[model samples]
Target: MPKKIVKKGKKSHKNKPTSKKYTKYKIDGDKITRERNCPRCGPGIFLMKAKNRVYCGKCTYSEFESKK
Candidate 1:
């Protein structure tokens, strides 16, 4: 005799919303907001600020200031 297999249908979980929260950092007025270009590297380089100096995703570099 062969055993019977049970198949289940897709379940719905629409009640929950899928969203992501990104951390944002404040930039000072003196902080220069220019298109970052790595001199050592090539073009298409940039950086993102999130409460502090972040690194260039493409270059993998980070910048930060020390508070005395």
Candidate 2:
């Protein structure tokens, strides 16, 4: 005797709910305060916040060195 094969449709997987969910960090406007130093840069280097990266105030160089 041969066993019967079952064919699944597209809706089979689509109907299943996700096991994990993603959450983002939220900042409180009233409680949160901005720091002067750049988080990306290590200590001893004084950096100022630029558009996206932090720039070293003393050397006038960006904390994120350009690749290549």
Candidate 3:
């Protein structure tokens, strides 16, 4: 005879995020402009842009939008 074993919690099935690095730059005429960078992290580090704010992944610095 064997005792019944129970499984605990269900595992998360979240999808992996995609890379959109190539979309970050803009080319207009002869000028090239890029997205904003993290103030705390300086030039090389870029801020992640969202619908209402932009934030830094490394430093966790966030800036929200102002209410109109």
Candidate 4:
């Protein structure tokens, strides 16, 4: 018996929402709010701020917070 060849389909991204359309920055009276993005991935990707470090889930990038 001969094996049948199958063609691969187009690449697909996960069903979850990848990026938010709204600005990450927020305004509170006279103050401005914002989120830090991943340096390696550029805009649209935000880093998760932890107690000691900031991390990016997409590229596994992280930076430790400096002690002051």
Clashes of each: 2, 0, 0, 0
Clashing pairs in 1: 25-50, 25-51
Superposing all C-alpha atoms, what RMSD in Å does each candidate have to the true structure? 7.6, 14.4, 5.8, 5.7
**Cα error, candidate 3, residue 66 (Å):** 4.2
lDDT per residue for candidate 1 within 1-68, as digits (tens), equals 88788677878757754431112222568764454444445554545554666566656766663456
By summed lDDT, the worst window of 10 consecutive residues in model 3 runs over 16-25
**What TM-score does candidate 4 get on C-alpha atoms?**
0.54
Whole-model Cα lDDT of every candidate shown, in order: 0.52, 0.50, 0.80, 0.80
TM-score, prediction 2: 0.27
What TM-score would each prediction reach against the true structure? 0.34, 0.27, 0.53, 0.54
Error of 1 at 66 (Å): 6.3
Candidate 3 residue lDDT tens string, 1-68: 79788887888878855556545667888989887888999986777888999888879998886769
Q: Write the per-residue lDDT of candidate 4 for residues 22-53, one digit (tens) a residue.
A: 34566779988666889999998887778899
Stretches of candidate 1 above 4 Å error?
A: 1-33, 65-68
